[model samples]
Target: MINYKSTLIPALLIIVAIACNRPKAAPAKGNAVWDSVLQNVQTAPVKEEDASECIKLNGQIQANEDHQAKVYALASGKIKSVNVALGDKVQKNQTLAVLQSMEIAASSNDLVLAESNVAMTKKNLETTKDLYEGNLATSRDYTSAQVDYNKALSELNRAKQVQAITGGRNAVYELKAPLSGYVIERNISGNSQVRQDNSNPLFTVADLSNVWVIANVYESDISRIHNGDAVSVTTLANPNTPLDGKIDKIYNVLDPATRTMKVRISMPNPNNTLMPDMFVTVKVNAQPASSMLTIPSQAIVLDNSKNFVVVKDAKGLHKKEITVIKRVDPKAYIQGLSAGEQVVTNSQVFIYQALSE
Candidate 1:
C-alpha cells in the first residue's frame, strides 16, 4: 500500500507541471515576433527637441562708401583767415580761407619788374629796327636788340604765371574742397602752422553717402563667403532692425593672431547718419536653396572625444556621431542622420544622465 501511494503522487506531480508549462494556444512564432515589434513601436517614447534649428552667428554693421580728403596748401604761407569750421559743409571750388605768404609777395614783385623790363625791351627793339632799315644801325646791333627783347618776353610770361598761382601778392591760399561734402576733420586752427614735410592732414572732408560694414569671419567658414554675395548687418544701437547690404569684398589674407578673415558689406546712409568705423554685426548669405537636410544647430553635442546627437532608439536614448556639412540660416545640413527620427532637443543633460546609468 505505501509503494502505490508514492508512485501515484510522482505521476500526479509530472502531469500538473506539463499542464501548466504548455502554451494555452500554441501561438505562431512569426506572429509572436510581429506582435512584440508592434508593442515596442507603440511604447517607444518620442524625443523632445532641446534646442531649435536656428543658428545664431555673430556679425557687425557699418556704411557702404566713405572717404577722407587731406586739405593742404600748394604754396606754404601763414594762414590769413579760415572761413569754415569743423563739421561744416563746403562746396567744390569754394575758398575755405586766405593766407599771407612772403614767398608770394616776392614772386609778385619779380613779376612786376619782369613786365617793366619786357615793355622797355619791346620799345628798344622797335627803335633798333627802324634804325637798321634806315641804314643807320648795323645788322649785329639789331640782332642783339632782338635777342634781348625775346628773352624779356619769355621771362615776363613765366613771371605772370607765378603771380597768378600766388593769387596776386600775399598768396591768398584758399583751401578748397575737391568735392562738395562736409568737413569731418580739422587738424589746423585759425593760424595753425602747416608744413609739406609733415604727414598730418590739415583737414579731412568725407562724403557720408554710404559706408562699409567690416565683419570678422572664422578661418574654417571663409569659403562660404564670396565676392558679390548678399549680406545683412545689425547694430546694438538699433537692435530690432537689420540693415540690408551686399558682400563687397572678402579678404584673402587670414589673420594668424585672431584666426579670422575680413568680410566687407556696403550699406547706404541717405540721411548721413552712419559714420566710418562704427561697430556693427554682419550676416553674409551664401546661396539660395530649395530644400536641404537640416537639423537643430544646437542639437549637436560636442565632447572631447567626438561630436554627436542623441537619438530616441527602441531600447532608450542613444548618442551617435554625425558630420556637419553646411550651416545655413536656421538649420545645419548634415550627414549620418536620418529624417523623421525623433531626437532629444530639450533637457539633453537630464536625458544623457539617465542614459549613462
Candidate 2:
C-alpha cells in the first residue's frame, strides 16, 4: 500500500512502450522479394497419371546354380596337395588338388598287368590260328586259345576304362575343375582325409559372371511379385554399383518360421563384383495403377507435427497441409492436394522459414 501509486504508473508506461516498439510479424510468405526469389525455384504441377510403384526388400546375392559347381572327392584318399585356395580363379579341367590313395595304386598296377597280358595273348592267338590251319594243332586246342585271348582282351578294356574315369596314375589321383570359375569355398586342406561318400563337397566353384539375388517376400507382399518382373539390385558394399535383373523364379514353399516366400532374381555380374552371401537391396517395379495426385518429393517440408507445402496463387503463397500416401524416390503420392496446383519444388527450407516467422 505504501508504494502502489508509484509502481502502477511505471508498469503502465512500460506496457505502452512495448506495444509501440514491438516488431510486427513479417508480411505473408510471398511478397515482392519472395516472388523474385521464387523465380529461381522450380515448380511443377501435381500430375494425375498412372505412376509405377516399387517394392523394396532386403536380399542376398548368391551364385547362380546353373553356373555353380560343387567338387567332391571321386574316391577315398588323403589330400596330397591343394593347388587352389578360396577366391582363386581357375580354368576348366585345371587340377585343384592331388590325392594319395592306396586303392588307386592297386588299380594302376592292375592296368599295367592287363596291358602286358593283352600283348602276350595277341601273339599266342596268331600262332594258334596258324597251327590249326597247318594241321599242326587240334581244333579243340585252337578254340581254347581263342577263348582265353578274348577274355584277356576284355579285362584289358575294363582296366583302361577305370583308369580313365579315376584320372589316377601311380598312387595319386587329381581333382580337376569341371568349369572355369573362382573357388568360393575350400573344405579340405592338404593332408586331410577325404571320403568318397562325404556329404559335403571339397570345393565350391562359381562362374560369377552371372549371379542370383534371393529376396524374401513377406506373406503380405507375395501378391505384388511374380515371375519375370523387372528388378534392380544394389549393395552397401559397393553403393555406386547397381545390377539389373528380373524375377526368374518364385518358390512355392513358404518359410513357416519367417512367414515369407523366396523370390529368385538372376542378375548379370559383368565385372564379377557380386559375391555370394553379400547383403543387397532389391527393388521391384510394380505396374502403375490408376491416375492419382502426385508431386515432386522435395516440394514437401516436414516439421514437428505435420508435412506442409507452400502453394502459390494470384493471392500469394500460403502453407497447405498435405497427407502423404506413398513415397517413391523423387516422387510422393499425396492427399489434400490437387492436380494442376503449383507447389514450390526447391528451396523449400528458405520459403518455409520466411513464412513460419
Clash counts for all predictions: 19, 0
RMSD to the native, candidate 2? 9.0
Instruction: Return the TM-score for each candidate structure.
Output: 0.61, 0.82
Q: Flag clash pairs in model 2.
A: none
How well is each residue in 1-357 modelled by candidate 1, as lDDT tens digits?
234333433433343344366533212344433233222321112222322222124654432334546677656777778888988888876777677766677787788889999999999999999999999999999999999999999999998897665454644456677777777777776776655455776667776676667788887777666787766677777767877777778878898999988877767778766665557766666665444456766666766666666676555445667787656554567667666665556444333332332
Q: Per-residue alpha-carbon lDDT of model 2 for 287-344, expressed as tens digits?
A: 7777778998989999887989988766665678899988988889988988899998
Residue 167, candidate 2: C-alpha displacement in angstroms:
0.6
What do the candidate models score in CA lDDT, each in turn?
0.64, 0.83
Error of 1 at 144 (Å): 3.4
- Candidate 1 to truth, TM: 0.61
